[model samples]
Target: MNHPNMKKDQPVTLQTFKKGDKYHHKIVVEEAGYINDVIFRLGRETPGSYNGQQITVNYEEQGGALVGTVKYPAHNKVIHNTYEMDGQNLAKTSECEGVVHKRWYNKQQN
Candidate 1:
């Protein structure tokens, strides 16, 4: 999620904070209105920029977490992700290449 006022071409840094570093984080979806579901991916680059990257997904409920697989045929690489909501936050564990990446996202309050 990003600030709605931010332009698509705006530069943004996506990094994890160090264990001892203090930081504030939130994923905001402002004026989202009504939707049937919320599905997204987290990466250094937008998912659309990946050539030959095929994505398949399904969800168990409306506006709920998703389970999906992202495959990069060009590199023979694949990432599998399973998502769930923990309390008010979003949590996911991704198996990419040979590494496991765990991510959590806090929902922003209005």
Candidate 2:
């Protein structure tokens, strides 16, 4: 039951930080090891000091290689995508945005 899909020769490690002006964000998702779905609330706003922040995620792996964490003070690492899976089962995604092996089923229902 998952649909909002995206996959294609995956590999994404995005980073943005600008304190003085504006711009702050983080989206980390590693592959074949760990570190899945780690993100920061915001990274760029200029309308009302943009107030909405809540991000917490931690992970570690040595053998397969995938590590990402966030505890406030500082520490954010996990950006690498190179996908090559397939799709079926009503929206099973993972052609490359990292690992998502067989777990999707959205039969278009509202």
Candidate 3:
């Protein structure tokens, strides 16, 4: 998925870190001409574990202006997910269950 304001084929980086007994993963995307970046973090759990998993995502505009964070819970296994500009929710579909979607743009400012 792509944000309207974000350029096509923008640079994205994924990194993993260990804190305490849990593992954390972070995915970051940098927007051209913007000081702020989009960040996504997975809950402290081993990979391939989706049950009860939580994902925290946030996007910030240039110059530290606008920022918003949204959280999604995986009651079931998530199969497909996408994010787009002007969209406030995480478009997700579960494997066992039906579609599960939630927006995380409550802290955004126009």
User: How many clashing pairs per prediction, in order?
Assistant: 0, 11, 1
Compared with the true structure, model 2 gives a TM-score of 0.20
Judging by TM-score, tell me the better candidate of 2 and 3: 3
Q: Sort all candidates by lDDT, best to worst.
A: 1, 3, 2
Please list the C-alpha lDDT of all candidates, in the order they appear.
0.47, 0.32, 0.38
lDDT of 3 by residue, 1-110 (tens): 43566666566453334566443444455563333222333332223322234544433333322233344455433343333334543222222246455433222243
TM-score to true structure, per model: 0.45, 0.20, 0.31
Name the candidate that leads on lDDT: 1
Ranked by TM-score from best down, the candidates are: 1, 3, 2
Return the lDDT, model 3, position 50. Answer: 20
Clash pairs, candidate 3, are 89-103
Report the poorest 10 consecutive residues by lDDT, candidate 3. 43-52
Off by over 4 Å in 1: 1-48, 51-64
lDDT string for model 1 (15-108, tens) is: 2222342221222333432112223333222233222244333223225555556556566777777767899766777998679988776665
Query: Can you write out model 2's per-residue Cα lDDT over 1-110, one digit (the tens) per residue?
Result: 11134345444343334466433443333442222233232321112111132334333333432233333323232223221223522322232235444333323233
